[model samples]
Target: MAYFLSSHITSTLWKLKPLALKTTCVGSVLAVNQRKYSSKDDAGSEYLHRSIVPTMHYQKSLPRLPVPKLEDTIRRYLAAQRPLLDDENYSNTVKLAHDFQNGIGKQLHEELVAQDKMNKHTSYISAPWFDMYLSARESVVLNFNPFMSFNPDPKPEYNDQLIRATNIVCSAVRFMKTLRAGLLEPEVFHLNPAKSNTDSFKKFIRWVPSSVSWFGAYMVNAYPLDMSQYFRLFNSTRIPKPKTDELCTHQKGNHLLVMKRGNMYVFDVVDRDGNLVKPTEILSHLKYILADPTPAPVCPVGVLTSENRDVWAGLREKLLEAGNREAVQIVDSALFCLCLDEEEMRDHIHISHNMLHGDGCNRWYDKSFSLILSKDGQAAINFEHSWGDGVAVLRFQNEVFKDTTERPLVGPTTPPAPIDSASAVQRLEFKLSPDLEHGIAKAKENFQAAVSKLTIHAMEFKRGGKEQLKKKKLSPDAIAQLAFQMGFLRQYGKTVATYESCSTAAFKHGRTETIRPATTYTQRCAQAFVQQLGQHSVEQLQGMLDACSKYHGQLTKEAAMGQGFDRHLFAMRYLSNSKGMEMPNLYQDPAYTAINHNILSTSTLTSPAVSLGGFAPVVPDGFGVGYGVHDDWIGCNVSSYPTRNVHEFLQCVQKSLEDIFTVIDGKPIKSS
Candidate 1:
């Protein structure tokens, strides 16, 4: 595979000799045509919202994601490979870049520009990028799906499962109302260094988007009974014939799916009058489900979701044939999923087991939001990342928790209605054949096997948080990213190509840009700590720290400007697929594969009030590291396959952060 750089590559090849304020890497210098940002005094705040927003109020004025000039993208692509490649390999990649820029790259850029013009009325990358995401060959299980868990609320009343589930569903409805009302402020991602450029930044900034697709659909994992074992069973008239087209769960609908103890229930969050139900009403409905004592025959249908995408798609079609079309409609129409688990889970490991693939019976993993409340009242959300990134979901979760914690929980003073009268909630029964029953049994075994291989470590670093970084005049995200880099270095004695998501959400419908975090400055900082140890001066370390932070900031701004190398690369590849063209040499180069094979996939979700969820490693050899930066403490969750020792790596991250404090404070060293 061809290696490509992301952004901010300078042409100058100056290496660090003695520590300096700014250290330039061996790459093309990033030309700064400093665009001034517009301050409120100059452009006025009203100019920010000048355009008429159509559906989503803040979306109308935002600019479309730009296609970078071929020369710049090619230059960046080459520069990114310099650090990872040997001299010979680097030279080969450079030549390949020349071949691409002059030959195939020119043609592809022209086609993309034409395509961009066609999508000028809409986002150029939106549809193409989404389709491409669906075409990936890798398993979506751990890599693509990300989850977050909220710690127990301060209120003791929430310990009652029914009360917690009700409040959570209501909180989600409140968020949904906010989304529909367009009252939630659109996120601002660009850090415009100058005030004059602010207006331009506002005009072109990427922002957290409001997408209809993310909210109302269930991600259906469909699997059929094993063909070899039940060839004769297919001839039975009782079985409904399966079709492949019905397998996908991406379509959106209007109902909610609630799963508990292998039983599935369908209910409407809205009344016939189109008004959302009250929290009291929702609580009453959940209590009804809790009162039902009959155990549901385990439907292993949910486990098929954890399988490969193509395989699940096939199985979903078959599962639908077993009298589940109506059930599917209810699932598709629902706002989201509510998982009512009777089991208690206090630690991250146990929470992960339930959230990731709970019993393979009570979860329908297809929905964008799957809210789970345990018997002990611990809550978490399992989000399918294909619809949006962590930031979008984090925003929703933050608001829900904020509303829950701030408001008083008051039950109705009047007597409640009997459970039998409420037709709002109904249990969904699936008529599964004996053959399908066998499939369910097999799926459960497979799901258990998958969960057994996963290793999770949930640790809280009480040492320091965002406030500590503020005191050091450092970006909290930057310091955490560096801590991850240092941890990786300590564990493997080398740095892997790292990915830290940078929001491009300043633009219309913007999601994220890959901010490659393993910079030359970070490399040197890690080297200084490992090789020099106590010998490195504070000035030298400070210089490195400043350089790393500045570079990261630059990357963020570039990503916001749609200059991210990854998306452009991804778009170009998708174009080739669209045109039925062969894969370019730039993509086929070894360097490309090396970088894309990410060994360290990390993201930071900060919500001062809640403990965010964690996810599976993106790759078999990698680890999924998510950290929450609060006022006084940092909550970290590290997960990997059974083969990798994430616990040790997390310990290293803690040590690295402490060591950083020691260096910044000029304190005496204590060897751990």
Candidate 2:
């Protein structure tokens, strides 16, 4: 989920409010002791911290997300608009914004604040955010769900499909057990892990009550994030409805759902006592499914999930009416879906395509998530967006990757246990009427048409990266964002609206806030390098880079703190629509529509466990850019529809990065 609000009128019917704030008063003695700890972690200790305290210990005392004042939101909103609009259009947008803040927006803001007081459990954006996703009429395949690919194992032999799948399944069950037992580590950002991540600190914090544990952790500058979405990680599915969808989770399911060649199979991974079955048993069952000689179904029912929400809802009703209720229940109540693809990935482009949407027949797009592995052992996760954000998913991935790689339960030489494989694994069979079969056929056609229009490409910049930029005292993220601006300018000779998603998970039940990266500073700096190269001195250009970095840093902090303007403005508009009030002139302005369109949708997620991540363009003529800035290189995996030139765009981005590196290295700017 990029935090872009859908412009569909039906999606604006929900009311939203911020979670109530919680204040803790710690004794002076503790405060003095906390001051002795450093906020910087020792080298390589950042990922060493483990959860000694219970997982939900910080839930009660975590502070609520704040509501920015109407004036501040207006100011920030206009500042973001200024870079994307011309002088005449900006003047018009300014008047509309002024009118809104002083008029109906004031009342809307008041009502939003009052509602925040009434609803104390979730952040202001939660309800509307959910509404934005569930209410979307498009299929979740490309328009909504995203994929993150796991890096190939260090040991080449471990990449064998059966070996990797067995290990992943076992590690996944262990993760579930650890989480259910409350022994899993809480997600935290340790500014200085050397102090807060020590055994003594963990022992002390373990004794603190759950209600006040957040305060204790905060004293040492350790920030624990919201883990409310973790519970939905297993045994969950998204059920389609006429106008919206609901997230369904069953806590008692013991069987695992496996799909291959459009056929469904189920086998028990958890015993009756809720303990994970032996890894040997899991391996045997998986081997049975893989060795089955059944061919692909003539009418693969799974593709129906890739249909439009309303269409899928209607087809689902037909399935139930056709006596497929038990089969549907088994799918919905299974622990999780594990997809075993028959084809091997050919390259990075093939990996992106295969992992993202895949041959629609072999995928269950409505599952809370799916762990997919190809025949060649390349693995990735494709997940439903409405149930949760990447925070929960990434944490789960990190743990699973660590467990499977570091302490794998199954090895290359491990043999499947001698057992009755046929009786152990049950193939799920659904009765289908002719109408349902026709629906499946149409769904396959639609899925093919939709995914066929997409073009994906990948690029890597080895000239410079995070380390090089850090040495120059520039934000690596800022430099990356600036590269996008310059790249767009160099390709299309214009600057457009861009979006970067920032997680607001520091607060209770928080979602995301939009980091509008196309700012006036970035625009000016991009123009200097892309258009006026050789006209400016290297020192002056370096100063511009510093300015862009500093401003971007400020934007990132503001968004993380829930002080960004986009969500606030979105909430107010949602409130207005729910109350049946006429749309505010500010929203009616074309400038508002253009900004929300977000031509360049970008998000960054860097993890040791992840090789790449990607999503499709949100609009027909846009780019879905997933990028990472590693120590020595920056990589981008981008997708586009036919309206855009993805290949040329990446070339421009690469050139822009090279030019920026040259300027940083005190070399003359290359003439365009």
Candidate 3:
């Protein structure tokens, strides 16, 4: 006989399965650190006074992240998988699900419930989730990680590389200051404000779970890779350097490492008082490095990080052993890395090439974030996914862009107090052994081989985006998601299971939830648009549109409530392993594999603040669509391999949106 547990335990497990757990954010590194002081006053002015500040002060007050009901989670899971399976397979899955729920499922759920109740850690899932993000996968860095590019800031007239870099430094410092001071407000789910609270708010700054001892069980702590390890961000190579236990301590130092022409320079970003030095002071050091003539061939050493994680880790051990302790310390201890790239970025393709894997040299890919500035002043950020999701970084980008645009800085007119220019910049030296040389050669071969296979296409859909969608009384996100689904169906001539990330930040420590966009409604909508064409009536088009919108909204709500299928199923599977249970037949069923294999992997980040966002496809034949939906325009970064035509797909997506707009407006569809 099984012991019946309280509902709270099941609910806790539900909450624990939130999709946002997989999302990451830049923690305290934006740079300022302060102690919490005042609480909110009745008028809300105290919070309002600090404008656009990112802080963790509200974390303690936020409600704990909640879990959804077990039954609800299972129901949503079946529904999500329903569209992808045939009747026989799906019916078998239904029986398996029922058997588990009635028999062993109850036991497993109870164990999880007990675990959640007794687990005093920051979050039960944070550590395991992070471990999978970091050490689990063989592919590390950019392939599995996602990145975004900032179009050149127009306000700052930084034709000179050093001056533009300085402006960026200052803006970054200001953003960090806000984050450190805990001034930035946390993001809330506007659709359900009631669910927004402190624990969720705390996730913004909570990199790794801080107090595992509270759980009385040894739960791995998921530290925010960005905040807790800010100083470590520079010498940071995802590659494990030798004497790392000792060298990691150097990351606490307050300096920024500069990688330029073929040399590495160390410079102080923080002054004696611990405040970031002024932009002019930083420019002085950059100027000194810029003056170096006849620089050596830039070390191809950074390429080791771009290799397969296991391969890089093995190579890093050798590289660290070969280099002097001091050199390793200098590389590791610097606060963050700044690359002074001399490449002229003429277009997005150039930007993608240089930023993703810059000539295999001028970059240390393991750093939490690498700020790469082209000679032409165009900038792109190559970030490590282990740090956090694109949301936090998006917030970081928005803040910096706003700072630069609002107050454009002309070149500094006055020189700073006389200081030895030589003292400001120190070059890091690495004495390579034959072993190190061989490792470097192998890493380069692997890096180039991987780079050759990717096909990336970046384009802007100027026809219509948020504004036109709103005019049609449609949700921009839902419609945009449909456009991609329609586009994929049109291109491949068949519908496949899709993954769309929807934020559950409203819940405590919420990350993301999967909204399967390839649903019955989506299929109907696509079929109508593709087949009916010029013959469709306005009423029929509206009906299809309404069905698609309704389904999208329903999934979004379920995801926000932690009732989406993916994470819950994942959590159930994870918990089974933890409890030493046998393999569940539900997971092994073909129906399970069908839905889990996402062929249309897409995400929408509709912000005017960010120009481009992208990620690799979850599957080889799939396309990764990271789109930004602005009022009148849509910026899309479509990523895939040689098997798919990303360029033609983008055109199809744009045309699909146009077709939908015309059909919805009661106009006849014009043949493309």
Give the best candidate by lDDT: 2
- Candidate 2 clashing pairs? 17-124, 18-124, 40-192
- Residue 49 error for model 1, in Å? 20
Error of 1 at 325 (Å): 1.9
Scored by lDDT, model 1 comes in at 0.59
Q: Let me know the TM-score candidate 1 reaches against the reference structure.
A: 0.80
- lDDT, candidate 2, 250-351, per-residue tens: 989998999999999999999887777888888999989999999999998899999999999999999999998999999999888999999999999999
lDDT of the structure predicted as candidate 3: 0.60
Backbone clash count for every predicted candidate, in the order shown = 49, 3, 32
10 residues in a row with least lDDT, candidate 2: 22-31
Winner by lDDT between candidate 3 and candidate 2: 2
Rank by TM-score, highest first: 2, 3, 1
Top-scoring candidate (TM-score): 2
Cα lDDT of all candidates, in order?
0.59, 0.82, 0.60
Which whole-number lDDT from 0 to 100 does residue 633 have in model 2? Answer: 94
Question: Which parts of model 2 are misplaced by more than 4 Å?
Answer: 1-51
Query: How high is the lDDT of residue 534 in model 1?
Result: 72
lDDT of 2 at 330: 93
